[model samples]
Target: MASKKRIGLYFGTFNPIHIGHLTIANYMVEFSDLDEVWMVVTPHNPHKKKSTLLDDHHRLAMVRIALEDYPKLKASNIEFGLEQPNYTVNTLILLEEKHPDFDFCLIMGEDNLKSFHKWKNYEVILERYSLYVYPRVSQGTIETQFNNHPHIHKVNAPIMELSSTFIRKSIQEGKNIRPMLPETVWKYIDEMNFYK
Candidate 1:
């Protein structure tokens, strides 16, 4: 692990990549102990309904566009080719097998910690890798259960109250969503007539 780069896996549906998402990933690479951050774009989140999300390719494209300016940050479609309802543990396992030279860490919001136990093989994930958690809007008061756990670390990344659902609604309602997203992504969305 000492010879490889410390990579943080930032998983999300990224319905349409927003500045908030990029902010967290960039902050992790720039401020945290992580050497790089990969935006693992999920095709479908078990917790979310499939109909509400954009196609996997579109979401992947948006992530790619949003990450163009960030060299240390990458957009990954690792979950797209994986099994149905791609589980985090499975993704991590595959990543480890595929890239033995990388030390992978899980990156998520503090809110997720509140329901960490609900995830499949949560204990194994906690025991095998580190978790870099950042604050999110509406995700108040992180749970104390993992406070003493050495594997979980709190990251002081910028927290944006914005959400993809809000952005999509804004777009659907004919309100401006430009402020919440990168210019390139906004342009692409407009060109593709997405979320309309």
Candidate 2:
């Protein structure tokens, strides 16, 4: 009798899942029509190098810790079981089969949007799901490319210029990363000695 929750799939490596990532997901849940936002952690990106990535399980754990306070936010390890060189199209299709009752949308930063055309099965992705894009500290090239797509909507989230790469670098250098992530997440990272 209860209605299924509308889920937004926010796929990313999440390398560390910092405050900036949380801010965008929170904004989407609060401001958009979606009922929840799932941080889908990708094991590996075909386009990105895996050399700089932290362990997938560790990254997922950090995401869980970061989102513990928000009941509507969840961290998913769906890609963990999938074969590597993770592709968004495949992940979306699998999620569709597994969670049939929930409505799904794709969430990404403007930077991803710009390079989305180069993604595998990009056309299928565009046709099947709506895209919710949050601005990042990058040139406005992505916005321009998809300006005509009716399914794409721009989100007005806080401009947090921080990044996972920055956090990782800070940790490697033995600098404090508390200011860049949520308190609970920072605690986990510190306790586990992640990125060190």
Candidate 3:
């Protein structure tokens, strides 16, 4: 029998889809056992203010354009249709029901790992699916319980310190941030005069 396709869900606001995000998603699909990586554009992150986000359609459009060249990486607007302030648990449930043939995993950075326990039904998530974590330059130590856990795979990927916030600030400051974003994405943002 054919094995279920493995997919890593990398959730983010992606206010602007920059090269750092592309690099991480690309690395996960290339260096790991997962078949593909989906960049899930969150409509609203509970931790962030709504005013700070770009319009949902704009953010999703940026992701779509940024991933045009990467076949193994896809832009997912799955959460766009979901209820506002949706939790990861709810998304996982829906995804499982919708794609019975795919084995989904969570793709996160080392920083988020420290706060994993605080997420809604995080334990249930760990019990059911694997977490493919990438390196990040973040404060705080990981919980001891996550140490050597089979479900949590700490991949030796490069540490990406670039952030959407930084990019946005640079653009607002009239800095040349084009190199930080995908060429196509940069063009889209420039054409739209986003963050200016």
- Name the candidate that leads on TM-score: 3
Whole-model lDDT values for every prediction = 0.89, 0.85, 0.92
Q: Which of the two, 2 or 3, has more TM-score?
A: 3
**Candidates sorted by TM-score, best first:** 3, 1, 2
Residue-wise C-alpha lDDT for candidate 2, range 35-76, written one tens digit per residue: 999999878655676688877888888899899899999999
Winner by lDDT between candidate 3 and candidate 2: 3
Off by over 4 Å in 1: 45-49, 139-143
Which whole-number lDDT from 0 to 100 does residue 141 have in model 2? 68
lDDT, candidate 1, equals: 0.89
Residue-level lDDT for 84 in candidate 3: 67
- Give the runs in model 2 whose Cα sits over 4 Å from its true position: 1-4, 45-50, 143-145
Lowest lDDT 10-mer window, candidate 2? 137-146
Model 3 agreement with the true structure over 70-175: per-residue lDDT tens digits = 8999999889888767999999999999999999999999999999989999999999999999988888999998989999998888888899999999999999
Q: Which stretches of candidate 3 lie over 4 Å from their true place?
A: 45-49
Best by lDDT: 3
Give lDDT tens digits, candidate 1, residues 52-153. Answer: 688889999999989898899999999988868678999999999999889999998878887888899999999999999898665455556688689998
Superior candidate under lDDT, 1 versus 2: 1
TM for candidate 2 is 0.90
